[model samples]
Structures are given as C-alpha cells and as structure tokens.
Target: MKQSPATPLPSPKERRRLREAGSLTQAQVAERVGVTREMVRAWESGRTNPRGRKREVYAKLLGTLAEEEEPRRPEVTEPQETLVEPAPPAPPLTPAQAFDALYAFCAPALVRQAYLLTGRRELARESVERAFQLAWQRWPEVAVDRDPAGWVRATAYEYALSPWHRFRPRYRHPEAPPADASDRALMAVLLRLPTPQRRTLVLYDGVGLDLPETAAETEASTPAAAGRLMNAREAIAARLPELSDPAELHRRLTELAATERLRAAKPPVVRTGSERRARFWTRAAIAFTVALIGTTALTVRTAPTHYEPPIAPGAEIQGVPERVAQGPLSEAEVDLREKLRGEMTSGPVRLTPLSR
Candidate 1:
C-alpha cells in the first residue's frame, strides 16, 4: 500500500519555484488543479494551501518541467574535490575530443548521483554509462548545448529512476541494509517516508539540488517539494535528533554509500545517430509493404467479373407443333360412328321364344 505524506504542507516559496520551473502561469496551473488563479497566487504568496487530491494535481502539473527547462544548468552538486579540480588547459579540440574531456570530467560525479538514486553500485555505473553513450550518440546536439553536463546528468538520473532498472535480475531481491545499527535505522526511516518524500529529500540534500530543480525532478510544485523536504527532515530528525541538519544526514549517508564496492557494469545499449534513423525507415518500409499487399489482395477478392454460362455438347430439346382441330364431324360420319357405337353397346338381341 502507498503511504501519504504526513504532518506538513509545502512552503509558498517552493510552490512558486515549481510553477516557474514548469513554465506555467498561475492561471494555467490553477485551471489544471481545479482552483482559481487567485488561489494559486495565494498559495505561492504563502497565504493559503490546497490539500488532498488538489495538491497532488498541482504537483503533477509540474511533471514535465525537466523537459521544459533543458538549457538551464542544474544547481551545482559537485563535491568539494570536483569543485576545486581544474579544467583542461585551453586547446583546440574536435567534437569527439571535447566530449571525451567532458566525459572524464563528469562521469564520476554523475555515477555518484545515480548511486544515491538507485542505492546500488553496479546499477549506478550502468545508468551513468548509458547516459554517456546517449550523449555520444547525439554529440552534435550535446556539442551546441549550453549545459551538456547538465543534460547528461538529467539523463543519467532519469535512467537511474526508471522502473526498468529496478526489475533487473540483480535487483529482483533487494539487498539487506547495512549491518550498522545507525545505517539500518536510517534506511528504515527513509523507507517509511512516502516515495515522493524520499525522492525529494535525496534530490534536494543528497544530490545538492536547489528547490526549483528538486521541484522539477520531483514533479511537485516548489512549495510541495519544500513541504516534502520539511516532512522528511522532520521525520528523520524525530528518530535521530543529533543529525537534524540536512547536510549532516547526507554526509552520514555518503559514508554508508562509500562502503559499496561492486564491479563496473556493462555499457547500456546505444545506437548511432544514423542507426536510429535507419531503424525508423526500416519499420516504415515494412508497414507500407504490408499495407500494399493487403490492399491488392482485397481488391482482387472483391473485383467484379463477367461470367458466361457453359452449354453441354448435345442437350437441345425439340419444340412441340401447334394443334389444328376440324370444326365438327360430318353428319354421315357421325351417324356411322353412332351406329357402330349402338351395335357395340347393345346387349344380345332377344328373339321372342318362337311366336309362343
């Protein structure tokens, strides 16, 4: 059974950020969520809040924000080391060269992000590598993008969260939590939060995303995202008060996460740019051929034909002649016939017994 978020509503600031991240106006958000524009404004201004299904609808209206804000960079989530690391010195490089440089720069961080979302080492590597493969496949598009790293990061996270990866053979049975009592307790508490709350907490604190970005990823209104984070943090704090600070909580998770040491995963399936186009054309050609053949067969089956009756070699029948009757028999012929008839019809003549 699914659990509902407990004990908090999102903040107005979170709500506003969600609206902006989604590129939706107050009116549009209000209409979709079954409220007035003023009500939406009130929510954003921290004056009021929707609850229950309406709140969920508001959250869902922001669902496609990730796709909408493609060019914007996600808030910096780099570790202190990655932040201090210097970029390669200025040098002219080909498209492949630049992207390779990019891959080396971003791969480690991206993998870590995936790991937080997936909670498995191999799955994380697979998610990040798959995302990079896609980046390579669309290098031309990635090349011109203002934030290629962000694009890849977004893609990696998308894959990591996919239900497909969860169903992989290795994941069919979830691994037991760490043996440490604290880690086990933390994991148990995190699991108890609603799915959205857990994901929101991870994205905001674990992944170091700002509110708007977290809202975008979680498909929640900014306020809703904030509310989720608040609820999650409060819930965790209730169990472990010393680590009430979100940062401390995240740092502890990192320690538990760092202990996982699985081998690298195989690369995800990625087709070349041309291969995608070729696959589409092949399917289209097959469909057209099948439709043409079906049409031809139907036409032939239903076509009208002129049919001629077949005649047997000797089956002719003769026609009958018209009848011709004499008007009446002549009187002498009639008398003769009558006399013969009387003679035939008469009984034996009686001769009176003598003249007695």
Candidate 2:
C-alpha cells in the first residue's frame, strides 16, 4: 500500500511535547513563529493549524519541515454587502415656536424669583406674566442670548419695579403669608431686609448668579451689590439666631431656593394662531377708525363753502343826484329886449319867453 503516507507524522502536539521537554516556554515558540503565545497554545492543542508563512515558521521552530519548503498562501475574498445610509435630520423650530418652548421652560423660575423679590403671590404672577409677554415680543433678540432664564428673571424684576405697577390701583404691600415652621422662619428673615438687599441676596445666593451678573441684572455697581448682599446676610442672620452654622444655613437656603425655583415654574398659556389673528384684526379696526376720522377732518379743512350774509328788510339806498344847467339865458334876454323895443308892439315881444 506504499506505506500509507506515514500517518501524517502524529500531529503538532507530539512536537510541542518534545519541545517542552527541552524547557522552552510557549512564548519562545511563538517568537520563533512570529505569532502570539495564545496562537501557539492553540496550535499545540490542535484547536487550529498554522497556515501560510506561519506554518513554515512553526515547522522550522519544531524541526518538522525543512527551511527550504515554501509557505502556503491564504485565499482572499471580497465583502458581499455595503453599509446602510442614515436618515435625514429634523428641521429646526421657528422663533415663535421656540419662544413658546422657552416660555414654558422658564415660567416657573420667573414666578419663583418674582415671588421672592416681592413676597406677594399675585404680584409675582403678574410680574412673571409681563416678563414672558415681553420675551415673546422680543424672542428673536432674547432667544439668542446665552442665558435666556437670566434674561427673563431680570425682566421680571424690572416689571415688578415698573412705574405702572407702582401707580396701579391694585398695588398692595408685599407680605409673607402664614407657613410652616421652616418657611415661616425663612420668610421672617427675608422680610427683615430692605428690598434691594433682599433682591441682591436672592439673585446671587439663591439663583446662583455671580457678583458681576447680579450687579448687572440689578443695575447696581459691584460695591453696591456687594454691600446689599452683605446687609441681607446680616439681617437674616440677626433674625435667625438658630442658623448659627454658616455652612448648614447655606445648605438649607440652597434647598429652599431649589424648592422656590420648582414652585415658580409653570406651563405657559399660549395664544393660538386664530387668537393672534383676531388681535391683529381688532387693532387694525381701531387704526382704521382713527384714520377715517383724520381723513374726514382733513377733507373738511381743505373744502370750499358758499356762505351768504343776511340783509335787513328796510334800508336807505345812499347815492349822488344827476346835474342840469340853464343855457344862454343872458344873450337870449338881451336879444329879446332889443327886439321888443324895435317892435314895441311886436306882441310885446312875446315876453312869454322860452317856456321855463
């Protein structure tokens, strides 16, 4: 049977055993084969068989095949498919839509800040609402700023201090309502400070703004802002003797601030397209009426009129008389006398002279 190819040389395990008996590590064999130790282990364990240049190196390292034997080459193949394309992204919202979103996001915070500043619930709501209205009008400008919430809060504070608010018939002094022990205590401390001091402290410490930002928002100098903050702290400290530990008090105050911020946040009531259109029409109608009145006034001013004055029933007509003169009276008289003498009897010269 031609010796049956000698049983394929009893596999690589027998060779690995032979090499191990010589006190060499798998890493040393791997270096000789230009492969990892794990690869060598797999080869020795019969989990894989070396191919290509690796097979040649392995055979040489194990003294099984001659160095002159050429290495076998691995087959190459192409992929059957390609990667899938991704879907397109969604479009961005318009300014009005974005305003609606931002208003919803910041309303509560605004309300809370207003409440803290004024210490009255209704005033706080009014101030916050007015701020949101302003924000809606200037959304294109306000939305581009880095901190929209800060802008809204600053606007709400300004609204709270507006002359309209000051002069409104419904204006009421801000007063803290009855609350639980912790809230009552907090309110008492807050109430003791001046409005500016309280507002500064709340903006800086409670709302987490830095000194410069707080000063800018409050329209005060850095030193003035700092003084207000200090005064507020001192006032609160004096009122709350129980808050002896500054760190603990700060922690509690931060928690209270978080609570206040959450409470103030509320969903905004948005005006629909129809409602906005209605408002536009209403304003247009008023403007049209005013324009009509103005036009009528101008027409009356420029138009001509036929007006006649009244005459008295009886009135004398004043004028001059025509002139008349006597003709050749003297000559006529002389001639008449001569002729009468000549003809004394000439009928008495017809002294009937010319008919007068």
Candidate 3:
C-alpha cells in the first residue's frame, strides 16, 4: 500500500501565532483549509493533528497566510530525550453522530449560500434540506470524502440552481425583499444576471470560495469563471457605485447573505411518476421560453432605431422644394400679391394694412 507522508505539520502553537499574525480568525483558517472552526481550534490547541491530505492542505494554507502577513517563522528546536506521552484514543463517531456534526456545523452557512443562488428563502431551505437528506442516505461515502461539507455544499448549490424550483410553489413572505433601497437594488441586479455570472459571483463573493473552487462549482474553466466573475462584479459596481473596492463588495454581500433569513417550509407531498415527469417537462419549457425572450429582448435593446420625423404639408420635398410661380392668382396668393405690391414686402413682413 502507498503510504501517507511523515512530513511534519506546523506546530499547533506556532500555527495559532501565525494565524493571529495574519489577522485571521480560527473560522477563517478553517475555511481556507476546508475544515470546521472546531477542528481548527482542536489543531491549534494540540488536541488533534490533521493527517494525510488534510495535513498537506493545512500546511499549504497556513504557509500562504504566513506569506501574506510576512510573519516570522519559528526556529527549529532540539529534540528532548525524555520519554514521550501518548494521548488517549478518541472515540469514533457513529453514523448519526457524524451526520449531526456535519449538519450542525454546516447548515446555517449553507442555507445562506443557497439563498445567494436561489434568491428565494423557502427554496433555499428546501435545497439545503435536500442535500442533507442525500447526505443521510450515503453517510458512509460522504464521511470518507476529503471534504464532506464541500460535497454537501456542492449538492445544495446545484439544488438551489435547479430550474424546476422556479416553478415550484413558493412560500414567499410579504416583506421578503431587502428593506434597504441599496440592498434591494443590488439584489435586483444580481438576480437579473445570467445563471453563470450569478453562480460565479455567489460562490466567489458570497461563499468566500477562491477562484478555482468557484470555477469547479460552476463547472467552468478558470478563465471562463474569472470572466463571469468580472462581468458580474462590473454589473454590481455599476449599480452600487459606492463600493470602491472588491473587498467592500464582498463585505456587502456577506452582510446581505446574513440578512436573508431563509425559513423552513413544510415538506411537500410526494408526486406520482407521471406528475413528476410533467413537472420536469413543464419547467424545461418555461426555461426555454424565458431564454428565447431574453435573447430577443437583448437583440431589441442593442439594435439602433432610425427615426423619421413627421413632415407638415408645406415642408420641403426630398431634394429641393419647387419655387412658387411669380404670377400666382389664387385669392390668398393675389391677396399676398397685392400686399407684396407694398414696399414692406420687399424685406420681412410688416403690420401695415394693404391698400384696397
């Protein structure tokens, strides 16, 4: 069997100092390393050592943080000759205990994440619940994944983005939209974006995922995801012009996600096979129609119009208007002629009465 490496991890005490020096909280470090804050605290306190791939990830993430902050590295210490003490063995978590652990730590944050994608509170809750339900069904496989929470999170994001949910019954509250005008405007712009841009922005900004993870979640290449993110950010900046920097936008999104309180709804009744198929097809049709309308609208909005102003009856002809005859004899024309006989007609019109 291939062996896990024996390379040393950062010492827990040293890591804690480094994390603090980087102005990172335990939770932030945990997120960067794809672990829970509790686990981060445990590692910092020397209660547990991250093994295998996790140790490697931890080391790399900490190394990056150290580089960013330019924290001083600790000097190597001489090994002590005294006998080492072995720590007591920890109890293994049963399936239920494991599920509870993952769920409790991840549910609130995942709900916030789902809300960013779906923009519907009940749908977000349902999406998260559906992911957890699947996790419960395959706890064995999930528990062994390198990042179990990441798996569940990816499923939740997919569920939130499912087109069928748009047609599903909504449990919308009267005051569901954000109360702040700026927030409401920002959300309006976000929800209007194409699915790719919205998903990339939500994952990159709202969930604090790095570019690679955002790209993976959106099933896009790094450059493609980066383009989507840039487009989304530009749209947002256009709407929220006060956000002078990307960090401020990220902070605003974080606050917005927290403000989006997604309440749970009662479980929906099971559908028959035919009804399920019908729902799927109906949603597919609606999505297709919406795409068509969006394309047409975009074309119409971008195409220029050539307007022709209305011309009055006596307005000039296409090239040059025909000159009026010198000997015109109509009543109005003769009256004008008699009037022109007066010297005032030689230049601009005058108010003097014409001789009878």
lDDT winner? 3
Evaluated against the true structure, the overall lDDT of model 1 is 0.72
- Please give the lDDT score at residue 302 for candidate 1: 88
Q: 213 in model 1: Cα distance from truth in Å?
A: 2.6
The clash count of every prediction, one per candidate, is 5, 3, 0
Q: Over all chains combined, what TM-score does candidate 1 have? A: 0.49
lDDT of 1 at 297: 97
Query: How high is the CA lDDT of each candidate model?
Result: 0.72, 0.68, 0.76
List TM-score per model, in order.
0.49, 0.52, 0.54
For model 2 the local lDDT of residue 225 reads 99
TM-score of 3: 0.54
| Worst ten in a row by lDDT for model 3 | 265-274
> Model 2, range 267-312, lDDT digits (tens) per residue?
3453343246558878999999999999999999987787666786
Q: Residue 70's C-alpha lDDT in candidate 2?
A: 36
The candidates, ranked best first by TM-score, are 3, 2, 1
Q: For residues 1-356, what per-residue lDDT tens digits would candidate 1 score against the true structure?
A: 99888435456687688678777897788778887665676567553466788877766655455456568767877655545668889888976678667777677666766665666667778777778777877888988986687688878877877877556688887666667887777777876777678778777676556677678766779999999999999999998896797658878767655655433332223334335755787899999999999999999998878776779589666886768877888999999998888784657777877574
Q: Write the per-residue lDDT of candidate 3 for residues 1-356, one digit (tens) a residue.
A: 99866657778789899888888898788888788665676678664578778888888878877788775778869866899899989999877777777777688888887777766777778787777777766667988887787798889888888777545455433226788887787778878888889888877776666676678767889999999999988887787787747768777877877886655332231112224555787899999999999999999998879876778578554977678877747899878878778756358755898899
Candidate 2: regions farther than 4 A off: 1-84, 163-176, 244-250, 254-356
